[model samples]
Target: MKILELIRPAYLEVRRIGNNIRRSIEYSLSAKKKDIKIAISTVLGYSEQTIPKLINDLKKYGFSGNSIYVFEGGHNKIEHSFAGYHYYKIDHNSFDLNGLITINELNLNADYWLLLHDTVTIGKKFKKMVYTCQFKNFLGLKLLKKDVSMNIGFYSMPLIRQNSEYLHSFKNTDYTEKGLLNAKERGAIEEDYIFKNSQNIGYVHYDLQYRVKCENDVMYKGRLRRMEYYPQLDMTKYKANFVTDKEWIIKL
Candidate 1:
């Protein structure tokens, strides 16, 4: 038993290293294939620093030459010159859900429309895996689902366009009960209604590493956490969504 225990750590370490190498090779091969055309849209408030980092991160994951539509809603504006990737900026005073609605209004063109939060980073494995799923007939993959909210911040296009009417209804409201119930009434399936049923969605994958970070603190789970100092804008127009118990460090 003592000898077996002594060899266990090294064996596990070797396995971990081998797994890492395999994942690396898979990521590289996926990047090389690069057949999907994804248009990324995100609401940017004061987190201008995150935009460039996000674009760079996506490039590393093989999302090259894609269009990035940034809806700027804060006092500061974000401008980028990343080649091979098309970037557009829409100046707006909206906040939260409204900003996302503004992005939808643009009607950008792409095979898939990816909605993302400024603070959350897309994982390489998650991107590659979702890329293989069938997104044409069904709704896009749900990146983060919590409680009754589907957290539209990390979803895709035809899904966004197909459900525009219902999504636009939440422009001035929060993504809480009313928005969800409305979605269900409009023909959204149980899997589409909440984040808890993500596994039932088939094409969706939950990536814990796609996290929200504030300062040095990070919440490896849950939807992206908004910064405290960032203005809530029109979030008060609707009922507040439930806050999770996940730990987040706010830089004040």
Candidate 2:
């Protein structure tokens, strides 16, 4: 088991390389040209150290400066700033129901907005295709049963700058849910409220792995094994690839 553990990272690296190559080829062959601008935004509450890494990874994937917007939530103020990116600090006490407040505050001027969480890492081809695709309302990934009421961490929302009233309405009420379960309920309710009224929603499935903290309070070397809900669905149709550095021993 120890030997297998030592070999996992190398194995995952090889798999990631292969996946990247395949995705790159597919993207090159099928990518369509579009005259649209995309702005990426993320709401950060606690992961200050992880935010820079996320930004750097996005830059590595060819995202231009100032194209990404970071909205700081909670009491933590980001000390580091990157050029060509916009940053806004929202008071921790603000009425944010699963980042709605942060999302509402942004002046999303692009044709599309890619909403992300700090933990998610975007692939190069995925980023390119997302911008090039003509879908007006794209859900980057489907929510699991446990997340049925909430929106996935990554989603693409059509940006309509002229329709400011709809966005401003999110700030009208505060989320009353207290704990984690209730918070998720709040998210589901809010997302349903926002998405149910919209037309033509599409889904693009992709792999999204989680990074867990070790007992030492540091991020583990590999991906964390995702937990299973009551009845698991066969997600094979999504063609999502998952690779973690560690074994499937640790539970998230």
Candidate 3:
């Protein structure tokens, strides 16, 4: 069974991270078992000119499969636009049930969906750890209690072996509920409610470094120019040793 990872990215007031996208795809290909077909799903709303460049870079990394998808909608706007040419619009909020519906439509026969975000990059050892964890959970050897959030980190981390059983359980389930988050909080953020509900259900790892960049955000580029190169993946700190780059790995 081949796995097809989804790459749906939601952006609002962030600069285009073309380098991040490049590194992400590279890391995905590197982490695969040489048999899985990795695909990317992205939403419209980044810098208009950067989309084509990002796609061109992906092609260079051999993203020629039939699993690449795009979605429409902005930070809070739902109306479609030409800027959304590369993506499609769906009914729902970000990181909510609509995301699953989009994935199900794209790779209907895929054994798993490895969701990637616009800013997520997989370290050298990420694939090994995720695959092992996912296998155990899928086979009933482990139980993953998590909240399905509307963040890049949650969606892009790569879901493994997301079969029909999992989908059936995930559908119609309003992971985001009113009681979970305050009315003001929910209105302020798009997918806050979903993230709250998905907590502890999956192997949820919070890598703070992968957060979206701000206009004045200051971060070291590390050894890898792309976001895929997670050199700072400290095992002692993050509880996972997903990097082997000596120069970039911080001694925790």
Instruction: Report the lDDT tens digits of candidate 2 across residue range 49-136.
Output: 4467667776787766666767554334433355667666554322223244455455434444544444444444545544333243
lDDT, candidate 3, at 31: 33
**Which scores greater on lDDT, model 2 or model 3?**
2
Number of backbone-clashing residue pairs for each candidate, in the order shown = 1, 4, 19
TM-scores for candidates 1 onward, in order: 0.48, 0.50, 0.37
Whole-structure CA lDDT of model 1: 0.43
Clashes of 2: 4
Query: What C-alpha lDDT, on a 0 to 100 scale, does residue 82 get in candidate 2?
Result: 56
Model 1: which residue pairs collide?
113-157
Off by over 4 Å in 3: 1-43, 47-50, 74-87, 91-98, 105-107, 119-252
lDDT of model 1, residue 85: 67
Tens digit of per-residue lDDT, candidate 1, span 33-152: 433444433434344555677677767776556445555442234344446665544443233333345546866455445444455455555455544433334444454334232343
Best by lDDT: 1
Task: Order candidates by lDDT, high to low.
Answer: 1, 2, 3
RMSD of each: 9.7, 10.9, 16.3
